[model samples]
Target: MKEIAKISGIAYLMIFISGFYANFAVLESLLDINNPSITTANFINNHSQFGNGLLGFVMMLFFDALLVWSLFGLTKSISKNITYLASFFRLLHALFFGIALFKLWNIYQLTFNASNSVTLQHRVMKLLLDFDTLWTVGLLFFGIHLIVLGYLALKSQYIPKALGLLLLLAAIGYIIDGMAKLFMPNYIDYKDVFEVIVIMPSVIGEFSFTVWLLIKGFKKQRGLQNAKFV
Candidate 1:
């Protein structure tokens, strides 16, 4: 449990860092929503922008893959059934995101193909928007994983109950936010409010869990309860 927790914590941190850089630093830097022409020119002139974003996504995927089994190892002993469910959801999230990476890569392809065309900017901008939507779609599965994992954490004596509760709240926020973005027509109007109400807690909860796992590791269960849970 200790080893698994440590591994998962490190992987979690890697995922956070790489994902943040990819979205905020690389992707946001290259893509200009207000002026797609600028985005296209930048990408054509400096392919390194795309390269760095791709690298970040690759690193995130690698760490996410590691985290899947490490998390299973940490929680499996608690309840094999619930652990499998949570792991399954998380793997699904990873799979969806892996598939979504193609959309991101395709942005480059579309950019190159449309370089000589008058509609290059429009096409590339549409693809970027599509990739963003795809990312949110993957987060839907991630939300489910968090909910199940939170339940397991609460039930298990090794993990903190407060962390479990926070996870649950975070999962709710993710689900609500993702669903609104994917389905609601006027989502943008309330997006900022949603960010404060939902996204903030989710970030806080996940970051707290990561820190706790790294610092404290997993505590051992004991006696009949431990044996039964295991």
Candidate 2:
């Protein structure tokens, strides 16, 4: 149990690091939602960094898979059936994210085929928007996974109740922000507000949970009495 917890913690850390590098460092500046021409120019000039962003996604996905296995192993002793459900949701989110990466790859490949700048700009912008929209959809599944995982943690002997509560709160943040982005046309007007909503709880809850997994780890379960309802 402890060993799996440690592995899960490390996987979580890598996901954060790689995701940050991909989304913020390599991709953020290149994106101009209102101006496809700017985005096309940026992509042409920074194709190497764009490829690096894809590489970061590769690393994040690899560690993300590791996290699914480790988290399942770490928590199954608490409730075998429930843990399976949680893992399945996470797997779905990962699948969606992988598909999103394909869209990004299409955008990156455009860098090599930019002989027609006008067409390339429009194409790249559409792909970028598609990638963002698809990722928002994936966040919904991720939120659901977090909710179940939080509930399991809440009922566990070894996991902290506060961590469970934080995860639950974070789940709400993600689901709300994701739904808003998909359904609300005025989402841009409140983008900052929504970002903060998701960021605050997610960073605190997920980061603290990761640190806890590394530092304290989990104790072996003595019985399933606590998880009989599962």
Candidate 3:
């Protein structure tokens, strides 16, 4: 159990590192939200960097899949049924994220052909929109997964209640941002505000949880025997 906790924590850390680099550093850099022509030009000119983004997502997905198992192992002793539910949501998030990556691939393929610049830019823009939509869909499931995981953490003797509460707040932030992106037309107007609301909680909460898992997750501990949690 201790080894599993350590592994899951390490995997979580890797997912954040790779995902941020890929999504923000590589992919977002290549995209011009205001102009599709410029975005297509970036893909055609910086194909290597675009490929690196794909590679980064692949790495994130690999670790994400590992966490799906290790997290279940870590939490199952607390409540087998709830742990299963949490793990299922995380798996669904991974599948949705994988489909989003597929959209990235289609955009990357557009770089090579370049038969019609106008048509090419349009297709790339559409694919970029598709990727964003799909990723937002994935985040909805991820938010639910975090909520359940937070509940399990609160019931674990090894986990801190403070950290568990932070996880719940972060989960709410994620769900709010995701729903806004999907349903609100004026989301762009409030994008920065929404981003900050989500970022503050998620970055602090998840990073704190990762540190705890590395430092104390291996210690021998027991789950709460409360009937409500079980």
Candidate 4:
């Protein structure tokens, strides 16, 4: 159980860092709405950005596969059905992100084929937007996974109840925010509020989990009785 916790924690941190780098260092730094050519220029000149961004998603898929299965293994004794369902949702989220990476690849290909044309620049920008939309779709599955995981955590005597509650709050935020983005035309009007109400909870929940898992690991107790570590 300790070993599993350690591995899961490490993977969690890695996923977080990779995601941060991809979003801020690569995308935020390079992408410009007014001059999409600058974006293309960065992709062509500094291929490392493209490579790093793609690698982050790939690493996420790899680590997430391990993380989800470990979670299922740790909590399945609580409810095998629910554990399986949560794992499935998480796996689906990974699959969605995996497909989204190809959209990035498509953008990269455009850089090589056509970097100067204004129409192509507009197309690239649109593709970037689409990529973000696709990632949000994946987050919907992630939200479901968190909800189930939170339930299992709360039910498990071996885990902290507060952590479980935080997970649930985070799940609610993610689901609501993702749905609003997809369905609500006026989503932009309330985006900042949504970030505060919904996204902040997720960050707190996940970060707390990561820290606890890394430092303390799962609490060993009688409540963990019958829980399969392997």
Task: Please report, in order, the local distance difference test score of every candidate based on alpha carbons.
Answer: 0.82, 0.87, 0.89, 0.82
Q: Extract clashing residue pairs from model 1.
A: none
RMSD of each: 2.3, 1.9, 1.9, 2.7
Which scores greater on TM-score, model 1 or model 4?
Answer: 1
lDDT of 4 by residue, 52-139 (tens): 8778777877888888878876678788888999999999898888788788888877776344777877777888878878888999
**For every model shown, what is its TM-score relative to the native structure?**
0.90, 0.94, 0.95, 0.89
Q: What's model 3's overall lDDT?
A: 0.89
Model 2, range 91-151, lDDT digits (tens) per residue?
Answer: 9889888989999999878786466478777788778888888888888999999999999
Model 1 whole-model lDDT (C-alpha atoms): 0.82
- Which stretch of 10 consecutive residues in model 3 shows the poorest summed lDDT? 220-229
Q: Please give the distance, in angstroms, between residue 106's alpha carbon in candidate 1 and its true position after superposition.
A: 1.5
Task: Write the residue-wise lDDT of candidate 1 on 131-221 in tens digits.
Answer: 7787788888999999999998798777889999999999999999999989999988998887776668788889889998999865543
**lDDT score for residue 123 of model 3:** 88
> Among all windows of ten consecutive residues in candidate 1, which has the lowest summed lDDT?
219-228
Model 1 TM-score, all chains together: 0.90
Off by over 4 Å in 2: 219-229
Model 3 regions more than 4 Å off: 113-116, 222-229
